[model samples]
Target: MPAEDILRIEGVSMQFTGGAGLFGRRNRTTVRAVDEVNLSVRKGETLGLVGESGCGKTTLGRCILRAHKPSHGRILYRRDDGTEVDLAALSRAQLRPLRTEIRTVFQDPNSSLNPRMTVQQIVGEPLVVNGLARGSEVADRVADTLRRCGLRPELMRRYPHAFSGGERQRIGIARALVTQPRLVVADEAVSALDVSVRSQILNLLEDLQEELDLTYVFISHDLSVIQHLCDRVAVMYLGRIVEEAETEDLFEQPRHPYTEALLRSVPRPDPRLRRRDDVLPAGEVPAPDEAFAGCRFQPRCRYAEDICAREEPATLPRCHFAEDLTLDGVYATDVRQTS
Candidate 1:
């Protein structure tokens, strides 16, 4: 635990075991949604978690928020008082007091916000639940947070239905910030917004981060947004991080074939910059039941070797040929590229 690092995750794995059959008890299999994930978030920095859907980015995010108890490994979180706690190991009673320090801004405000609750109640719930404020104090804090999120304090008495989509998203942000959380896991925070409104939300997030000195784990499938907002990006595939690096470096000089394929998938603004049809392999991500003996990506990798199917790579950019292959990223070659 460096003083600058606010949180660290070591070998964290999350699994869901369920039974299947006619009565749903004959056969059981464990689906590891997240596996051996290790990461660090420095104070005031935004780290982006990116992958196709079902790649376990959101599961990992929820694990950090302690919304899910990880089946294995530790989630080491540093509190503002210079004390350290393993969030994974904390009991509910012990974790309750620290909930104010960690929060999540969920995607889809339409579903996340309770329709029955007023704006003030929705935003102030964290404060009330955490015993941080009572009655008028909650309203005051909620008002200020709403104002910071570009919502009118006067609107606090209104219900979620009264606000537009963008305004509702702002309300969601207000809810996350009202507690003055040091670590905020924004799971697909702006993906549901319209393109125009998305930029507004991004700008608001950036401004708030600067003002509050907040650390963020921003999860999204939108690479353009990730490239724009993240200081660093972690590319996940099959419940594991294949590559993690500074945003610019990862986008410009991707070391893994999976990363290169991801970069190629990003739609280019110019027709000339578009990727060719045959450059990368064409295959779907593996299903949860499609167990791999070695590298999880071998099923979809065009450059996979025999050893790749027999042994997993041991490092970040989890590819046996990462050092040998000259992969292309967004910045490396705008035109079509071959591995």
Candidate 2:
């Protein structure tokens, strides 16, 4: 692992077993929510995890934060002091101290924040719980955090119900940042807001990352948001990372067929330029418990051949024709213009 990497996910996988009957033989099915995945997150970069819903983007993020324990593999996290530890192996007691260093901004602000608690209490709870501050000191810290998130310090006394969707999201950001975390997992952080408000929140997050020197694992299905905010992008499909590259590189020249299809699905502003036949692969995602021998995407991939269905492809550059295929990407027009 590189010394500069703050988080390393090595062969991580999460499995859940279900389907037992009340008075029958044990016939459980194992669902691999996250299959053997390896990823490296640098100290101060935003890594975007993008995929369709149920593609395990959220599951992977949860595994990194230790909210959901991986059934297999190691999650190595390097602390701000340069101490490396396996977060996946840590017990609840052992992981408590590190919680302040890794925080999460959940998808739904309404459910994340306690409606009964005022903004001050919601944001200050972490400080009080961690024994980071006391009494007036906690209040002061909460006010500072609120201000930093573009919220008024005076609003700290009000309940979350009084705030707008964007304001509530800012409050959520304040809560995540109040502990002064080194890494923040923003799981669909701005997907619930208005288009106008989304930009404002995105800009705020960018500014905060600069000011705080924060590393982010931004999880979202929205490719546009990922393009706007992430430095690198990792495409997930069926509990595995299909492709990963720098944002520009992935947008300009996608390697995997799944990645190409995802990029093609992104809507362009010009209606005339949109192609009617630019549809994604047919059929829904396969069931998590349904075991398959060959490539999981072969069933839907237009480029699938006999070899694709008979042999399982390696996770890294899974496609047999990855090296040879000249897949279409968003930069085709730009390349043409330049030429």
Candidate 3:
């Protein structure tokens, strides 16, 4: 049976304006940060979003949380109250209450945390701002939430700078979880930590999800981490989702050429298992501002053929065990086509 979906993103697109005015005329360029992206997250499940830098993984996460309004498409959110809301359609005033239902934990903890605020104050801010608690109640809730996030009581009185990368991330998690949100978007939450600490934070996140029955959208560029933490994975490339499938299925049999390339790029731990003879593709990632005629990856893709230069490929259903697919006798590809 299929899991119940708690969030649905349909045909979403985001664009940012760049460049300045020249001689009273604006030299405007549009950066398509996210383009026609679609996905659904099952209730109480962790959906890992993986992509290279500038692939729109973070952008998609923010859009789901209503932090970034979509220029096109809808974000349908199934609230805990059994009500459905088109988050992308709601105005700031209309969406205020729903904000508490979805929270974000950014990549960098230090930048996200306030240096002047103590741990208690930082974690309690959400509860107080949302009017869920006050005065002593706020402190109590903060302390309890901290404990849930694996923070000691003594650390609650200290500032964010006083903590390690893992601890600071825990504080960030504490702040997001204190609101008791139904959905949390962790954008590269564990990327900045040391490998050892990253594992601890991932475990803590998993534990919290199980304990609270919370849903997560975990975004990262690390395939190895996603392989372990995600139930399903979405791969993004150039502001689009290239492929999405169950974690094990994706790693074991990636059909998309881009996904295959990405997996091949990962360093094999055992030297005996390494594919040193395989040719690594070269060329820089294309500028987001430039529009592609067909597939965005054609320039660097070794398998790209004439059809790839003239038409964008749709993500079609393929055999789970097959890495190669026929596109007029050519291959189609992603990290995402997160995206």
Residues forming the 10-long window of minimal summed lDDT in candidate 3: 328-337
Pitting candidate 2 against candidate 3, the one with the higher lDDT is 2
Local lDDT at 47 for model 3: 98
Of 2 and 3, the candidate ranking higher by TM-score: 2
The TM-score that candidate 2 achieves is: 0.96
Residue by residue across 1-339, what tens digits does model 1's lDDT show? 888899999999999987787887588888999999988888889999998899999999989988999999999998888989999999999999888889899999899999999999999999988889998999999999999999889989999999899999999999999999999999999989989899999999999999998999999999999999999999998799999999999998898888888888888777557674554657787776568788998887888889999999889879999889887878644565445
**Which lDDT value does model 1 have at 319?**
91
lDDT of 3 at 199: 88
User: Which residue runs does candidate 1 get wrong by more than 4 Å?
Assistant: 23-25, 332-339
RMSD to the hidden true structure, all candidates: 2.5, 2.9, 5.9
Give a tens-digit lDDT track for model 2, residues 193-217: 8899999999999999999999999
lDDT for predicted candidate 1 compared with the true structure: 0.90
Whole-model alpha-carbon lDDT for candidate 2: 0.90
Error of 1 at 47 (Å): 0.4
